[model samples]
Target: MSNATVRPLGYDLELISTIYISHSKNSVLPLLVASLMVNDISIIAIDGDHIDDVRTMIDIIQHLGAHCIQEKNRLIVDARDLQNFDANIPECSSTRYSLLLLGALSARLGKSKVALPGGCDLNRPFDFHITCLEAFGNEITVDNRSITCIQKHSPKTEFSLPYPSVGTTLQAIFSTVIGDSRLAIIIRNTALEPEIDDVIAFLNKAGAKVFRDDSNITVIPVGRGSLSAVSHEPIHDRIEASSYAFAAVATRKVVLLKNCPVKLMTQALTILEQLKCIFYIQSEHDILVDGRSIEESDPISVVTQPYPGFPTDLQPILAALCCTLKAVSHIRDEVMPHRTGYVKELEKIGALISSDGNKITIMGFESLSNAVTVNVSAPDLRGGMAIIILAISNGCDIRIESFNQILRGYSRIISNAHILGGAISHEHP
Candidate 1:
């Protein structure tokens, strides 16, 4: 008996592919199609192959909420069986992008209850969500499974956060935005990582009382006010772009990345430069990172934060990529505090690495030999794809369990891997 069944258990779609590849879609297609399925827009993809494109899909779902469907079912969601009974999940509460959902769901229901999100392998001890919600005067109850918020007792009020947890901050907005519409908070030590400012800007646009200084964020909700139909494009998914960019680096080859949103990669590009690698800025959306043989004694320091800083999400991919570098490297995961994983898979390919808590130490191998169908699993999105990158590169037949984790972020991994000349195709586990 195999750990993964020949069929995906309770999953919507599965892929069986041989083409080393992914297909590119106009980034806006999913948003346009899913949001306006009843209108001129229509959503279609060749197969499960293009599903790894995460950011585009997020943006599409967000935009779709504004319009009401006459023939709500008219929008044809035509695609091959990514799976049967594939429930088109409306954008609600998600652990992956819970921060993105906070204000939106709060607007829909004065209180939002997100089933405890499950992804990644991090020991998320930061009770910032509960702490922040309590500060906002909302009654919070945490059981084994989910955190529930109730507002029947407290006067519509305000609260503050000690840490700038992205999800907590968003939840604050959602809880106070309705009724009184005058909810304010002081967010302390909150995440100020890259792209968070954009999220703040979106809140401000919705007629919320949102103000941020060097220290704290304050929000006054408009009680489900109507936001003007937004017509702006989303910032490119820096995390996803960085993952694929690292894939090219892992290959020790030069692959041109179009639409890469180069500015957001300050942390990653800087590391590559410190490694004496080369990257040519082709355009706002294009970057060419040149990989070279790494040094044996190169020491690296990594810490995770919100936006405009090292992303915690990239820690796993960075660790995996560093495994092939010539030098011994170090990465400390200050954000989620998960011991850097995914690199363990590299050991199966003949690399040496060690991790404790959030800290990781990697000793690169001269070359990684291929695997012969190693049973593997993806802890989270980044680590999942990182494993796939290492697996396919080693020319081993890899069984990546829980590929759905990869799908939570990337739209299509198999198709893109093929495009990058990787001999990867999905199989029924």
Candidate 2:
């Protein structure tokens, strides 16, 4: 496990200022792979900050025979001469998002094999993905370490997800777009997150016809070799934006987040407002958070749901902020029940928190002011961000084990913390 040391950098209220965050790479990865399904000599350029897991996915695609290159803020991919179909690599095993390769490669080639994915120990099962693939008439076999998928026949034209899972939705889309173009695929109860819409837009721009109505998504495939080259810029990272907003609130700093997707974060912004953190929507894509008023605010309640609801990803960060409040707060993560692994680590920092099933109750106290130097391991991605927020808010020295957990999602976290006047450094081993 990699470790990160966060030293106390006494808060300078004057140093708090605006920071620019790039578009969501989580929203970019599926599109990057989807671009490769198109057999075109024309280059597909994706504009975003590609680092950490995004870079890992790029490497995986290159290994699968796509010509991928990084040029500053853009990733250029040429899949015209694509050959390999196997993605059973160590890199794939390390990042869970690599599972999307199964669907993409299965459509491009008749069969594909990939190492079982690993990321945060969130207890998120890949069975939903396998179910979605099987719905498309694919044959799947699982070993202890890897999964192999083979196209048995033409994919099914209609399928409905038992739950609105984002990964499964993307899998269904990839399977349809690159499958038999004669079929018009219809998917019900699909996740309507901005990232899902972004992928649909990329597919449409690349010559596939995809439409979303309410909770259902319809894909009209344009057949293989018909999808031409296209360039797409992914939407800004709403989860990343919310994380910084929560940091500002936890530390009582005024932070202007540029390129933030204010609309996509309406639910999170509403919750922040209830906590007395004022927001100035400078533009459609920028928000200024005045968190100095948080002390006067009452504790708030949050329930995580799909898009347009308080995001489950921000639940841990909010729970951390609640610890610094003077009243009780309640949070229910209806999305992922086993996501409270960070509560124990937060307790080490003096947070009074408990969990019952998916419900969490936090007895708010001034834990930040009483924080002491501590060593903790990040339980997951957002959980690590929550830990760092507590340490930065309290100006407490902390050693965070398994720091790579944070890098899996937030590639620019260290640099962004530095911009916020945080004294943080990580050492890889």
| Alpha-carbon lDDT, every model | 0.54, 0.81
- Model 1 C-alpha lDDT per residue in residues 1-429, reported as the tens digit of each score: 657647543322222111222222222222232222111223322323334334334433444343322232122322111111111233322333432232233333444444454444566653766665565555666556555565544433434466666555555544444445543545555555434455444334434466767646665544433332333233556777777777766766555666676777788887777666666776887776554444425666777766667887788888777766667788887767764567676666555778887788878653444534677777777888777776555555666777877876676566677744576556654
Off by over 4 Å in 2: 1-15, 41-49, 295-297, 365-372, 419-421
What is candidate 2's local distance difference test score?
0.81
Clash counts per candidate, in order, are 37, 0
Give lDDT tens digits, candidate 2, residues 17-59. Answer: 8777667866877777787687863243444555577778888
Clashes, model 1: 37
Please give the range of 10 consecutive residues that has the lowest summed lDDT in model 1. Answer: 78-87
